[model samples]
Target: MFDISMAEWSQNAPARARLLLVGGLVALTGVLALVFSLREPGSIAIAEWWPAASAAVAAALCARKHERPYVAVGVVLLVFLGLLSGGRSLELSFLDSVGNAVEAWLVAAIIAARRQQLSLKTVADVGRLLVATVAGAAVAALCVATGAHLVGLDFAASFVPIAAAHALTIVCIVPLVIIPRLHFRVSTPPKTIAISGALVLSVLAAFYPGSPAPLTFLPVPILAWAALSQSMFTAVFQLIGVLGGISALTIFGGGPFAYVTGAVPGIAFLQLYSFTLAALALLIGAAAQERRVIERERLALASLVRGAFERGPNGFAVLQEAASNWFELIEINAAAPALVPDSFEHSAGQWRLQRASRLHEIISRLSAGTEQTFEWSAAPGAASTAQLTITVGHQPNGSRTVVLAITDLAPMREAQRKLEEQLARERAISNELRKLNQQKDDFVASVSHELRTPITSILGYAEDMRENHGVTADEESLEVIERNAMRLLAVVDDVLLISRRNSDTSEPPARRRIAVGRAIDQCVSDLGRFAASKSVEVHVKVAPDTYLYVPESDFARVLSNLVTNAIKFSVPGATVKITADTKGDEVMLEVEDSGRGISREDRDRIFDPFYRSPQAIRDGIPGTGLGLPISRDLVHSMGGSIGLKSVLGEGTCVEVRIPLVRPEATQ
Candidate 1:
């Protein structure tokens, strides 16, 4: 048979090197002792001691292995040696020796039970465990008596005191072992307090003298509580208490002879056999708990990783680089599963084997944690307006997680196409409006040229008649003709300006960086005479050093139009406030009127071309109805914007924001 006992994996056994080292040291020590004791120089006396040395080595191996069967065999070997020393005269009784045999069985049983617990999962299999504790203690007691009998000692008298001492020991140390095993799911404070209390009680009990003669049944109540608790940890702990507490009590007793050298107090001899049983049992229980925890932790970790893998936003695959050389789609999310539902072993429809794919190289580097993100535009015929991004996970090897976030091109693309179509239509309409304005300008120029000669002639004749002919006149008729002609001439001049100046190119728009405070001041100064005619004043409120980059003429036109409207709409003596300030790089200018404000519904439409407010219509205000729109156009052309805000009764404020210099622009 193969020598399984000599295998490297043998439990707790020393290695060959250890054994050899120990043997050499022991040999040297024996020589030293012989030389010292006798005061003579001599070689080690090995010739007479070969068998004993061999036996000792074997015993050491048996004990170090901590296997129950090996231990039993070792014990039998020792007993055999004892019998050999005494010869046939060393007689023994079968019934008296029964206790020793039973104790051996109990010790073996407890050791095997603990090993099984460490290897097995379910607590339903602790049958040997239940048998080992009580049975082992009783059997140990019996062995001490049997050994006492064999030695021609007073077995009965010694057994009672020793067993009582064992019981006291059991009561003391058992609780210490058991408290650690109760893995109760409670708050930490309560558990700490409870474990400490148990330890204190056990220690006290151990030191106390006097208890039942046999401690065989002392651990029963705790074991019962353990079984009722249905906690494997609890059960193991209680077993520990039963085993360790009792063993400590016994081992600490007056024992060096234990079972063999029965020369010391009987208490010492009693503990030797009993304490061994406790050690074996506790070791087994602890090993079992460790195994259970390791298994549970492994399973819990697997569950957690699997959950993240399956529920994450993107699809994941594990690609093997073998003869199969294919990606196995491992997990897919609810949103993206339909697109990358499963992997293909070989290329099917659109898929192709790429000899060198940048995508693949990128993924390889990402999986190695060399890169976090890889961005690339969509492939040809793919959505043109969107891009793809791939972010890598931490794990190495396998195909890197490929996150394909594709934006749909339908809405934005369609909107852009529609915008182009609308722009074309607007361009055509703009061309038509420009032609109409050109025709109106031509007609006004023609009418003014034709009417200017006759008006000059009539004015000249009237002046000539007043100066040269000295005729009697009706004062009222004369005043009426002069006043009416002057009024018609003024109206004609306004019509000419409105029709022609809109398209007239003057000095190529004159681009410059104009301070908004200066701009507003200029507008007020230019329109001061007009405001004076209506008995209205224009108030300029502007912070200093506010600058903007714009075509000076366009900005000036915007200011001129807004201030003109403010003065026109305001009541006489109502001041128009024109304010200017800078927000970052943009110059914000405002013209507020204290006249009747525009209505909420009309505010937006008032900026439309040819649009007039209801209040202006009701008041019969004479306007071209192109002021706000023209102002908006001029402002936007100069990289600026205009807007109007008002309450129904409160006055109106026309706001214009023009861009600053390129170096100063915030955007």
Candidate 2:
């Protein structure tokens, strides 16, 4: 348990302690052995007073694992020298020494195995030690009994004394050695001294030589006094001292134990008395120690709670109920008095008058053991307001007291008012912006419609001039007029579409389950002539069974715009690929082309209405810039998304995903 080794034994501080302990145990064992061996025949031997054995057991219990072998060796050698000095045969001495060492080791092992249970400050630990002591000593006694029988001595007599002595020794000394050491001072030194003196005197008077009186009860009350008033260590020490003295006196033909007819019976009576006294003292001392610990903890917790209450930010006042349903202020924290108005006690101001009436209602709720809260101010235009919370606390004697807490509400109210004003201003600005946006959309829609009619009329008139007027020389001019008119018409149509989509009153186009493969075929067929004119190839790859839930005309317009843009941007002989496939629950459509792609700076805002790329304007590439925006809006209305991936000078791929019509929905 101590994590010690033979190397650490000499180098560590505990090693020195162990050496001193072993020396003391050896010296005590030597003296006791000498006294017992030199005893005269037919005299009391006091075999139940083996203090050295208990001390050896305590040392073994406390020793580190690696240090135990050295301790055991010391014990065996000490016992052997003492037995050999007392004139015992070499073989008998060796056997007896081995038995004692084994007993100490066995008892130590048993107690250490249950170390957590053995605080040695409780009656339960004392009882456990008694059991272990009896078990170990019984085994040692069997060894001694066998040795005596082999040597032609009385085996039964040797066995009883051996067992009784070891058991009694352990019961007396082990607790004193193993209990937690304390540096406690007696509260009343004079009273402690008097009780200690009384105990010593009683032990002497009770065990007087040849007294024929049963005065043994005299020391019982004195022992109890020491156990209850003194520390456990002091009480246990006194117990051992009294028991040792009584045993010594009885062995020398004195005390009530000496009056017994037989030596064995007298030794047994002394053993019983010692064990009873030891158990009583240990139980009382342990109970006292446990109670002291609980009381100290309680006082510490109370102090902490009081400290927090006094230092907290909120104002607090404790009120106790008085006669006739009235209440009186009993206690207050540091902040409480400042929060209370001077007029509240005088009952003069309107605030104080209102509080007086409110206190009556608060007291009623508090008496009913319910918590209540309310706000109050000094007057109608008071600069500050406070909220009071009242809670009931029950006392140990069943009387109820109420605690009132006050909190300032001025900062919270001001924050709420400012937040409301900010929200109102935001709402007004938002409404004005909405109205301006609506007017812009209306103007674009009306102007686009007017321009579309004139543009169509110009294209028709240019066709008639080239065909009917036979203008052979102005043919190129007529063709230019028709081309410009067509481009203007396309721009006007795109603006009209965007405005219609932006209008709140515009209804969504009706949807149908259109075959996506057929739609792609129709879009490519319409773009075939334009692709040929630009010398760009158009590739269509579509799944025949793929269907989409969208308006057919809108889908055609979105596909046409995408294809036309790809053809316009691509170099001559470059391929424009249109592909559509079903993926999961959606239909994926892609239009890819090897073209001069848009730059990253232009791509971000390319979807904005009328936002033509600078490159397109510089290169004379035609685009209304509303193509992607209108495409995105139309796709969104039909529950789809559109995005593009482009690398400048490499190519661009515009991908669109639209929800596929399910068979269950079609049914």
Best by TM-score: 2
| Clash count per candidate | 10, 0
TM value for model 2: 0.64
Off by over 4 Å in 2: 1-46, 114-119, 151-153, 183-188, 210-212, 251-253, 315-361, 364-366, 376-537, 540-634, 642-667
On residues 372-451, what C-alpha lDDT tens digit does candidate 2 reach at each position? 78775665466657777888876666666888887767668889999999999999999999899999999999899889
Candidate 2: Cα lDDT at 438: 96
TM-score of each: 0.29, 0.64
Error of 2 at 310 (Å): 3.3
lDDT against the true structure, each candidate: 0.51, 0.75
